[model samples]
Each structure stands twice: as structure tokens, then as C-alpha cells.
Target chain A: MQPDPRPFDEPWQAQAFGLVVHLHERGLFSWTEWAGTLSNVIAAEQSDTPTNAEYYRCWLTALEQILAQKKIATPDLIDITTQAWHRAAHATPHGQPIMLESDPKRIEVK
Target chain B: MHDHPHDHDNNLDPMTARVRALETILTDKGLVDPKAIDAIVDTYETKIGPRNGAKVIAKAWTNPDYADWLAKDATAAIADLGFTGRQGEHMQAVFNTPDQHNVVVCTLCSCYPWSVLGLPPVWYKSPPYRSRVVLEPRAVLAEFGLTLPETTKIRVWDSTAEVRYLVIPMRPEGTENMDESALVDLVTRDAMIGTGLPQVAS
Candidate 1:
């Protein structure tokens, strides 16, 4: 069907999509290997397919898996940063970009 | 169409931050370019679409030999037509006939032929569509406002990481004299997805 030209539902979706593509170009993993890892993660969903948001969430999960597999970063490392971003996002006022330095936890670490 | 406005990062969410975190981590490690991420996003978001696939569909309708090639080996045929090096490297052309209508769904993930169709529609990636398209294609298609006859057998092709299928909707009758470019206008993105039929040539 002729769907409206909406490539992504959200900006993060685009970032997630691009992040994988750029990573592949950097030689972290081949496209085939990336596809294989993504397929496996989606296969785990089995009969229950993901919603668009959840689908990209799967993308993020696969990215983490790929990075971890390559020993570039571990789940714990990503989780820490992800949580930090979450805190920063909450701390930031409306209409402001959520910079990582805005995270309250960073102050504790310092 | 969603309530979530993606234009501004200020109205934040968990997934948004999560991806940002990844980008930040990768950037810190000297493995990523923040600007490149924006560029890739812009290209996929605004530049790519199903027009490429529509061109292929139109060509197949106008050229019998091209149709044969598409039927035999879609990847090479489509690549020869100048659509390659995108999301799906392995692909197949699933033609819809008078008796048998073909529909595609990626029950595993969103395994679309991005080289041809660009990104899959949001509906195509939804849980309901991915599940119901297999168990009851007729019912699922009906939801998309495409109600094929009970006599017309509906075949649901499950896309895998290895091969993604593109549905070539049968050409509308009474367009034999139309040029390839004229025929292109009739082919809709949804037709290629098997969720919608092409517009009839006037």
C-alpha cells in the first residue's frame, strides 16, 4: 500500500537505525553478521512480534549484543550510560537537550 | 500521527535516552561521528521511500522479459534495474495472480526489502500485523481495507534475514498502450507490500 512517507515514528528510531548502519561501515561487524544477530533477537520473540517502538528497542538490544560480542562494550557499561542519560533527561527542563553532564550521578562520581 | 513529537529531544523518553547513550558511548570511544548519525537519519527519514520499488513494478508490468527475470532471480534483476546495496541483499519477487494473491510479513522482525521498498511502514512492523497475517491473512488484509475474494487464495510469505519478498500486484487491465512512466504512477507502495492494490489507470 502507499503509506505516507514517515521513515521513523521518532527521532531516536532514526538514530538507532543510523547507529547500526554507521557501525557496520566502521567494520565492527559485517552487515550479514549484524543481520544474523538482529534476526536471532527477533526470533526470540517467536509468535509475538514487536510493535514499532519495541522493534527499535530490539534494535538497541541487538546493538548492545553486537558491541558486547566484539568486546567493545559490555551490557553493564551501556546500562550505566543509558541510566545516566535517563537521569539527565529527567533533570533537563522542557525544550532543552538532555546532555550527559546534566546527569546528577555524574556529580556523585566526581 | 503519534502524539509523541520527535522534532524536539526535550520531550524525552526512555528509548530516546537509551539510543543517545549508545551514540555517546560509541562517540567517546572514537568509533562514531555525531554528525554522521544525523546525516544517516536524515537520509533514511526524508530521502528514501517506495518510489524505487514502484519503478520496478512499473517496469515489470510493461516488460514481459523483465518480469521473467524478476520471477527467476529477483535480486539480480532488481539490481540490474539499479536497486542494490541497501537493507536486503537477498530478495524475491512474489507476484499476485488472479487466483493466488501474495502478501508479505516479517514475523521474525522487520525484514523488508529496503533496497526496493525503503523502510517498512509502521503498521507492517506492528505485533498484530506480524501475528495475524500468518494465522488469517484474509482477515488481516481485510483490516488493511483489502478484501480479496475467498476464491482468490492468499499466500503469506514470511520474510527472513536471508530473503525478503516484494509483492508485484498484477497489472490493472486496459493499460497496454500506456508507457512505463505512465504505469509507474499506478503502482503504490502498499501494493508492493500486498496490503493495498495499485490505483487503476485513468
Candidate 2:
């Protein structure tokens, strides 16, 4: 079967893509290290067979796991940040860039 | 075209939320500097993207030998101008002629020549474009507001592997007297993607 050649549907995917490359370039992790870690995570999650979107989800998961393992971040911190973004995004009006609100409650609807 | 997996949820996609969260976490922890990331992103978005490609196209317009070089070995020709890296390591330049029109799409993934084109636009990666362009090139081009002549045969190049394709749009007519800099100004990123044409002086 041929692989799907779809572009990222959202800006975040591109951002994630950039982040991964940037991190690797900065020597945070070697490509071989990333490949091994990512493949293992994908294998464990049965993401061995994943759609284009799911593939990036696997990339994120591996990234998170590696960062946590390396003590670069705590899983709890990531979760907290993720929920905050969700809330901010939900409160923001349509057709606006989803700017992160330092205090989620302070975001004006307008 | 396949319907994207998450359309009904009008909220920012979960991935976006997660990435933002990650950014925040990384920044707070001092593991990654947001400013540095922004600099890299800014460079690609502004300094490096299609402007680089425009210079190549413009040079090709003025220099026949250079055009021949690009046609024969895009990687080498582009590298000659210092536009070679990453997604563009393996490159191919396709030319458009009166009888032939070229458009590029990567049906499986968004593998663009970032060294030359920077980031792929959101629409390029959307399901409709990824799956439909190869099958219905005319319709997709039409939707982009590019109405080509019926006699112009459309050739859709599916960038299925390592070799990325860049469209060398035909130089607009009546620009015969224009210099390379003016011609470079006329070449927009969309034109290089074949969704738009070079600026026609009015």
C-alpha cells in the first residue's frame, strides 16, 4: 500500500513539525534516538497502522515521553497547559487567532 | 475526497490546543526558548520561502543556460544559488508551456520544498486538495481562481517520494522588457505552486 501524502490540516501540525526538527537540530535528541523512541511508542500504541493525523499524534506522544524522561518537563505541567489552551480556545470568538490568555478568565469575548 | 476526521468539533482542533500547551510548558520549564523557535519560524515564513524560489525562477527567465541547468539538475542548479537544504535535498523543477501546465501535490503527506517554498499552506494539506488534485486537477485549479485555457493540458505531479517538485510557471506575456528584479517581484508563492499566475502588469 502507498503512503498518504497529505499536508497538515492545521497550523499546529506545522508548528509541531517545526518543533521536532528544531529540537533535533539543537541536539536535544539524536535522530536515531528519536526514531527509536518514536517507533517504540508507535509500536506500543498499535499506531503502527495510523492515518496521517494519527502519525503526528504519535510524534507528539513520543516527544512528550522523551521530554519527561529527560526531565525537561513534567507530564503534569503538559496536561495543565493543554487544558488551559482548550479553555482559552473555547472562550475565544470565531475567526480570531487563538492567543493564549495568561489568565483564561481575563479573555474578552470580543 | 475523504472527509477530514474532525470537522464537527468547531473548537480549535485538539492538536492545536496540545501544541500550545506544550509550548507553554516548555517555555515555563526553560527547556525550550519560545523566542528562538519564533526566530526559526520567522526566517522560514519571511526570509527564506518563495522569495528564494522567485530568484531562481527570475534567473531562469533571463538566463537560458541557467534554465537548462535547472531543467537538467534542479538540486545542483538551486544549490548553485545557495537554496539547498532539508526538504529540498532532492529537487525537480517542472516548467509550464503554452501546451502544458504543471501542478504539484503530495497526496500522502505534506512534503514541500521548505528550503524554497517554506511551509505548506493549510489548504495544501487539507483532505480535499491532497486526495483530489491528482484526480481532478482542473477543478482544484479552478477553485484557486486560476482558470487556464481548455487547450492547456494539465499535468499533475504526485510527489510520492524523496524528489520534491517546484513549478516554474511560464513568464507572463508582455513582460518581455521587464528586468530580473521586476520579474522576481511578480513571482508569488502561489504561482510557484501553480495555483496562481505571475503578476501581469496592467
Candidate 3:
């Protein structure tokens, strides 16, 4: 039998899926390489949080590790962005779209 | 002066944190163009939605032959409308009748068909939903503002990474004259997921 069709339950899950494909297309990492890293992450989680319901969490962790290992993003930069999303999500309305708000205190290199 | 509307929930925001982190890094190094990312997200966000599934459901409603085709071969019938890929490689359509009500859940993981119904909502992926829905489907449906009669049988279809289920809600009453397009307008994401019923003109 074929795999069940509906697999993702959240918008973020789809976005994360797309992001992985986009990164791969940009030559960041091969799916084969990703498979190994993801397996390790999943295996680690199984040992740690065996009942973890967050499957996408594993995917995100693997992606982060690959980016850091490739020197594409530093840990500090990632932290800043993560914090920014928290702030943005915090500020946005319940039904409104979650968008990153430009931090006036920080300068954009662009 | 006040732009803050959403409460800052400091507890357990790891998913948002991880995704934002990746987006930042990819955009910073020029490895990913933000516009491209937005375009992809937009396709799922705006261009695609429950309307696709609604159209399918509406077709099934209007045409008995199409409904049979959907029941016998959902993946192909869905693909007939060009909605196929990724998480949507396979599909199972569960019809809702007066005697039985069907709800979909993924206890192991959130497996949803993106090609037809687009992305799943946050609540659908919540741990409470993943665990509770299977244990007490009627209760879960109640929480979603869906109350079923005591005599009605509730069946919960557990979706896996291999196959996803789309709940074909019983068409609402008072819309017998509505065309497929109008019917599409009544089909909502929640209804497709079996969390809620299709819209009924009051």
C-alpha cells in the first residue's frame, strides 16, 4: 500500500519541508547526507525523548547542524534570528501573520 | 502606539526558534533567496488551500460516479485534478454518513496531504491532539465545536507518513441548489480534517 497522503499538520511543517528542499537546491547539502544526519538526530531523540511527538523538531535540528557544520551559519547568528522570531510572534495578533519585525537597535548588513 | 496583540508565550517555542534560525542563516549567507522562500510559502498559504480539497469534495458530491472513483482510488482521483506530490503521494477518502462520522488523526506524527488541503494547522499537530484524539474522538470533536449524536458512530483514521486521509463531510442541508463553486465556498479546512462541519447557511 502507498503511504498515507496527509503527513503534515502545521504550516511550519510545510515551510520546513520547503526550506530543506530550497537549501538542497542551493547546494547546501545532499539528501543522502541529510538522511544520515537526520537519522542520527532521530536516533538521538529516540534515546532521549522516545515519546517525542515533534517529528519536525528532529528535521529542524538536523538542518541546523548541517548549516553550522557547513559554516553557512554561525550559532550566534542562528540564536539572534530565533530570538527575533520569538519577539515577532509575541507581538503579532493571534490571527495575524507572524512576520519578523525589524529590530531598530540592530543594524541590517543588507 | 500599541502593536502588541499576541501574548508572548515564553514556554516551549522551539519550533519557531529552529525555523527562524535556519531562515536567518540561509538568507545571510546568500545560500537561499528570501523571495524564493516567500514564493513557495505563498503558494501553500494563498494560492493553495482547502479550496482544492473542497473542489474535490464538491465534485464527489455532485457526481456519484466521481464519488465512487474517489472512494475506490483517491490518489488517482485527486491526481486527476493535478494535486499530487510530497506528502500527498497517497490518499484515502472516508465518507461521512448520518450513521458514522469520521475524524482523522496522526498519533505517531502529523501526516497531512499538502497538495490538496495545503498545510495543517497548529492545533492539529499539538501533542494533545495527537494523543487525545485517538483515545476520545467524540470528546476531541466536541472540543472543536463539533457535537455528534450519541447514536452516531465515530471512526478515527490514523494517518501515517505513507497514506493520508481526507474526511468527506456530509454535505450540509439547504444547499441542494448550490453549484460546485458555491459548494466549494462552504467546504472548509476543518471540515476536510473532520474537526468541524462544512458551512451551513443559517
Candidate 4:
């Protein structure tokens, strides 16, 4: 389903925003063009109610198009990212405790 | 556009329905080109994946001084390996200790450290994981079959701005003497996500 819109408003939201900006600045897509497309997609989805996956797919699609248009990254990059996305969706086992694998030689900073 | 039985409003399963609806809109609007998406995914898989991160992990395991350098400046350290851009240019590694287990979640959107870990998992970008992981990290970890010790302090890292984070999991027990490749085997995808510990084959 639709993600809680709250997180998208946080300061941390800028990370993704900045990523979009970087891609745009790199000539992938103009800010106006990207924003117009994204806003239109979001608005359309909002009219009918959207799922989380649907929204993400939309976002990823936008990213992919922009990257392709700019030729910032080759088609291969998109394939790899999508494959990882699919593999993780299916292969990530449920209900397991996760541990961080530290570099043994690295000192832990408090 | 075309009326599909699985429209967002009509679907019972919110997740599936939403994805379908969004896909329809994206396609209809020409916002997302599938061929392009596939291409981007392919690039990351072939050119930069966990192997790059593994190299960093391996070096840290074998070289004490290098590990020290990595902990201090993961970005520059990773750059030394010729892996830079997209996500890894500005990197930070959070170490997981016996008393402290660290996990990372973007919280906002899927702001992953692609430079090191390559592209993020689909779940990482999913609303369920992004929304819930920060709010209920322990429960999320439980889903991954990762249980922390009661005494262990749980720290959730939020990747923000220019800095991206990679979880440095503790070396599994009985693998102190093992070589790098053996150690890499223990460093699973979960370890990067801070959900599961790396296991060494006894």
C-alpha cells in the first residue's frame, strides 16, 4: 500500500531528492521535466490509491528513464539493480537476527 | 488507462495492487521505460555488486592498519579500490559489536550505499521495510532471523545526505584463522543489511 507520507517530509528525505538533483545536473533529466513527470504520476495514483510497490516502481522507472536519457550509466546498470531488487524480494529469509560483519582491523568509534 | 481487473482501488492486497497501478500509470505516462530500467539494473549487477564491498571487507580483515583507515574514511578507502560514484563516493561503515548490534535503514526513501553494496534490494526500497525498519528495527531483524542479545544495544543508522553507511558485522567465531575467500563466504548479504550475522563453516 501507500507508504506513510510522513517520512517523505523529513530532513532525511533530501538524500533521495539530492540524488534526483544529481542525476538531473548530470544532464539525465531536467529538474522541471523530472518533477513534472513525477508529480503527474503521483497525482494520478493518488486519485485511485496506490500500493507501495507501485509507487516504488514508478520512482525507479523515472530514475531509469532519466539515467538512460542522460546516458549517465549504461543499460547494464539498470539490469543489475533490478536483478538485485528481485533476488532480495524473493530470497531474503523471514524472521532472522542480523549481525554486522565488521572489518576486524578497524577500530570501533563511539 | 486500460481497465485491468487488478486496478489499485479494486485490489485486496495493497502491496500488489499498488505496484500494478503504479506500473500502469508509469507506462501510460511514459515516465518509466522498462528497457531503461532493465539496463540500469544490469549495469550494477555486472559492474558493481557485493564483490566490491567484499574486497573492502577482505582488506579490513587482513590488514589492521588498512582497517583503521577504512573505519575513519570509508569513502576514500573505497576509492582506493577504484570503486566510486552513485552511492559509494561518500561512505561510512558502522561496526557491530558484541554489546551493540547496528542496523541501517533509509527511513525516507531507499538511499542505499550503492558504491559498496552495489544496488539496494527491492525490499530495501519497499514501503513496508522502509517504514517499519526504523520504527520497529528489532521486529524487522526478527523477520530476518536475527536476534540480538538482551545485553546488546541496538543502533539503527539513518543514511542521510552525502554519507552512506555499510554495516561491519563481527567476524564469526572459529574463523579467526580462515583466509579471505573463506571469510567472504561468511559475509552474506544480510550482514551488509545488518540483519544476520556472517557464519563461518566450522
Candidate 5:
């Protein structure tokens, strides 16, 4: 559960791992605790069978929640990260058109 | 991180202004604390860096057996290379074949195989990528300079729960004799995303 110091060997991996370490050092969930919680969440979501994507999403959601709960990241930081994500999305030339405004209230119920 | 005077300028872009507005609302609602922003930035800079992905790709290109192992059991395979846990413990790599083009997206949110590919790129987590990739994969891939034949089946992999996917694009033609390091150089971040294939420089 303690984030393996060697989990990431590449520079990028180390950098990413460093972010988590920073969060933990800042009083966010310890690496072990975070890994345990994430594993448990993934396990609970699994049925007799589970898809890879489902498992991926579960872990991601858990990571996001843990960060949010500890206040390790501000909404602004999340926004900036997500915005970068948006730019990558746009970089891809071919993909289905996705409607950003999904809330029923945001759409006129004609 | 260097200080940005431009960030403090009052004439904010529409997106920045909207973000500021949202921040104010969230702050007023006691949803987000102010100190958290600094912590977040610190984490991104000092903790989760981009080197993770680079390493995975480098290894994959260098070691065919390792690449095959990664395609089969990305988590354990990566761990064998001493890259496990943290953001990459649970991972998968989908192969992009001649007849089938694979693309990855996180529809609900920006779910990524961070352990292997490092952190998800900023755009991979964006609404446009998530919403559009599933619905319009060909158009998206096209933007990335990938034009698949109509007969080529486009399989969009959605990274959701504990399993995240990285694309293993077919090594380009005419680079059979290249050494691993040379091969690694051809695997770009975009190629791993399935937007482009690795091409040996002329």
C-alpha cells in the first residue's frame, strides 16, 4: 500500500510519483492508504466479471476523490489539469462529437 | 515554477474569467479551500511528472518480449521492469493492428493508465476528448494524421475503473533493423494514444 518508491523508474514516472508523494507528505492520504482505498474501491465495483475500462475508471475516480477529499488539490488546479486534457482532446482530429453540456437543465426540453 | 506576471493581469481571457468565477462560487460554498491550490501545483510539479510514460514507451520499443508481456499483463509486466504501484499498478495496453485501429478515451472523466504512461495528458482528460472520441473516432484520429482505411475497424478503448490502456501501435515498415533506442525514439506520446503510428525519420 505504501507507494513503491520504485513504482516509477522513468523521469516522467518519477515526476508523477513525486506528485503523489507531495500530496502524502502534505498530509494527504499516505501512499499505502491511498493504494488500499483504491484497490478496495475497484474490488467493490467488480462483479462476477469486470471490464478493463470499468476497473480503470474506478481507480481514476478513487484517485480524484482522494485528492479532492484531502484538499490536496484546489478546484483551480483540477480545472487547469482538466483544461490541458481538453487541449489534448482537441488535438485528436477524429472523434465523435461530444456534447459538453449534459445536464437536462442546461438543455431545453423541447 | 516561475512567477507569471501575465497571470495577475486583470484582463483575463474568457476561460480564465469563467474559472475565476467558478472558483469564487466554490470557495463561497466551502467546497474548496484556498491552500489546496498550492498543494496541487506542488504535487504536479514534484510528484507526478511526465517521465513515467517516456520510460514505458522506451522499454516497450527496446524489448519485444517485454512489450509482449506488457500487452498481456501490463501491471505485472511493468512491475517486472521496476515500474509498479503509484499511478501505474493497474494498467493494460491495447495493440493497434493493421485491420483494427485502437484509440483510448475516458468518457466519464480523464481516466488514464498513469502508471505506465505517466500522467494523462491534459487533453485526454478534457470533455471534448472524452465525449467525442467514442462518437467520432475516425475524425479524431484523422486530426492526429492517422487515416485508417474504411475497412479498418476502429476500436475505441475506454479507460474507466482499475484497468487503464495504452496503445501499442504496430512498428512502422522499413525500420526492422533499427536498434531499440532508435525504435524508442519513434514512439511519440501521440502514437501511444493511437492518434499516430511510429515512423522512422527519413
Candidate 6:
């Protein structure tokens, strides 16, 4: 069926966007850091001329950088977790919600 | 994106299993709340966003200045219409001309212009549509019931994780008297997706 047309949105983008707000609310990073990093990315991206995607992609990048810098979720940790999630997704059934329980790399509980 | 234990066979964010998977990881790590993300996406998607693409196309068809602006800078033009949001989705407008036809596909996953095109149809996220559209664009377009002449150059654009594309279809003939609002009605989601054409002036 024809899904009605709307502005182009990816669930991940919204999740990323919301994640920033939530993290900020939780005091994971200062608003100054978020703004500065995002501004730097936008400024760097302006050379290519900012479009919509590049505009917000900075959010994902800035978030990652900030998280990494703060050692909250380092780049290596994010990478490892991303792979773990992939494994979990494969382990989970098609129709079931993927859970960390299904992560094959998860340590056995006591 | 139902999280229930019910017997529903569908997955939440089926088109983007990878991102959904990442979201699960993030949730598990206390990086985000599932319900909040859902609310944000739902609010943005449902908020008067459905018509922005058609309006842009319609305006482009009716106004040369706006069309030129869209060609020069799609993001600014799109933002000028008050369509900008904090979310990622840098757009590049691709126009179908008499000589060059553009079609968009996401070879890796269903990276559609979801905000403008809405949620992707099942066929769009299907393996055949995703894999075949890039390899054999002409045949794929024909299967969508769009037949172009041999001379029209068909360019297949792949929407990557970093960027998305919008297809601005050629205004149909006999639409000279149609206003922007009237033209908007003629713009179909498929037309913007490059899978079909705008409704012929009728």
C-alpha cells in the first residue's frame, strides 16, 4: 500500500535526536559541549554545503565523540556493542523483540 | 514498533533491522528510552509533514525561482518551507528531465525519504526492489509500470545511511493552468520516489 508521503525520517535519526536530549537532561554532557561539537561538525560540513542529512548526521557524530571523550561509551565499546547487537538480532526470532538476553556473547548469569 | 508479547508476526522497524538492533543496544545501556524515541518519531512523522514534499514539487513546477533555488540548494529551500527538524536527513533534489530519469533505491537497507515519502511500502523494502533496482533500473522501472523510451537516460540513485534523495518528477503536459495546490494533488508518493510518474493532467 502507498504509505502517505511525509518528511523523510529514519527511526534511527529520531532515536539519535532524542538520545541527545535525554542524555543532556541526564547530565551526561554539558549543553556547551553538545553545541560546540555540533557547531564544529556543521562548520566542517558547510564546505560541502549543508543539506538536511549532513545537518543532523553531525548529531550522531557529535554524540559519539562526546560519549567517547567522556568515556561513557567509548568508540571501541560502541563498536563491540554494535556487533553484539547484530548477533542478538540474528539469534532472536523474526517476530520477537530482540533482547540483550539473546546476545550470544552475554556472560552466563550466576 | 510494537513491543508486546502478542502473536503479531511483524517486527518493530522491520525496514531498518540494523538501527532497531542498535536502538535495542542503546536502550539496554540506558542511553535512551524506547517510548520517548517512539513518541519523538511519531510526533514528527504525524505532524503536518506529509504534504511538504508535494508542496515543494508543486511549487517548483509553478515557480521558476523556487525551482532554481531547489536545484541550487535543496536543504535551504526545503527549510525555507519550514520543514527543517533537528533529525538527520540531508536531502538532495533529483529532477527527472526529458532526457535523464532518476530513480532512488537503498541497496543496503530501506533508506527512503521517509519523512517526505512516508513509511516505505513493503515492496520498497523487499529484496527484489532493493537489489534489483540498482542493477537493472530500466527493467525495474518497467515493472513499476513506468515505461520510458530507450533514449531517456535512467540514473539509479542509491540512498545511503548518510543521505537521502527526493525525485522531482517532470510536470505533466496540459498542467499549464493548474495552480500550485492543484499540482500538489497530482504529485504521488511513487512519483517522488521515482517508481511512478505524477498523475497526468486530468
TM-score of every model?
A: 0.82, 0.64, 0.65, 0.58, 0.53, 0.58
* Candidate 5 C-alpha error for residue B60, in Å: 4.2
> Which of candidates 3 and 5 reaches a greater TM-score?
3
* Candidate achieving the largest lDDT: 1
Q: How far off is residue B34 in model 2, in Å?
A: 6.0
Model 2, span A1-110: residue lDDT tens: 11112345556765676677678767788655776676566555632234546666767998998898998878888877777777767766654566677336545543
B1-202 per-residue lDDT for model 3 (tens digits): 5467654433226675667667776776678886777677667656666778998999998999999999999999988988885432479999999999998886654567777777676666556787788899988899999999999999999876667899998988888999988888888888989999998767
- Give the per-prediction TM-score of chain B: 0.87, 0.80, 0.81, 0.76, 0.71, 0.80
After superposition, the stretches of candidate 4 with alpha carbons farther than 4 Å from their true spots are: A1-25, A28-56, A60-110, B1-41, B87-89
Top DockQ: which candidate number?
A: 1
* Candidate ranking (lDDT, best to worst): 1, 2, 3, 6, 4, 5
Question: Per-residue lDDT for B1-202 in model 5, tens only?
Answer: 6455543212333333333433434445555554665455444445643345545666776688888898888888767756565433367878777799888886654556655554565456555666678999999888777888999999998776556777877777887787766666667667777877765677
Candidate 6 per-residue lDDT, tens place, B109-135, comes to: 456664566556556655577778888
User: Candidate 1 on A1-110: residue-level lDDT in tens?
Assistant: 35548877788888999999888877777777877787788666533544567778788889999899889888888889888888887778666666899888897889
Candidates 1 and 4 compared by DockQ, better number? 1
Q: What overall lDDT goes with each candidate model?
A: 0.83, 0.75, 0.74, 0.59, 0.58, 0.70
Q: How many Å off is the CA of B117 in candidate 3?
A: 1.9
Could you give me the TM-score of model 5 versus the true structure? 0.53
2 against 5, candidate with superior lDDT: 2
Q: Give the TM-score of candidate 6.
A: 0.58
Order of the predicted models by DockQ, top scorer first:
1, 3, 2, 6, 5, 4
Two-chain complex of model 4, DockQ on C-alpha atoms against the true structure: 0.03
**What stretches of model 2 exceed 4 Å from their correct place?**
A1-17, A26-110, B1-36
Distance from true location, Cα of B171 in model 4, Å: 1.0
| Model 4, global lDDT | 0.59
**Predicted candidate 4 versus true structure: per-residue lDDT over B2-21, tens digit per residue:** 65554222112332322333
Going through the candidates in the order shown, the clash numbers are 4, 8, 16, 47, 46, 11
Q: What does candidate 1's lDDT look like per residue over B1-202, in tens digits?
A: 4456554334457788788888888999999998988887887776667888999999998889999999999999999978885544688999999999999998756778887777887778776788888999998888889999889999999887678899999998888888999888888888998998998844
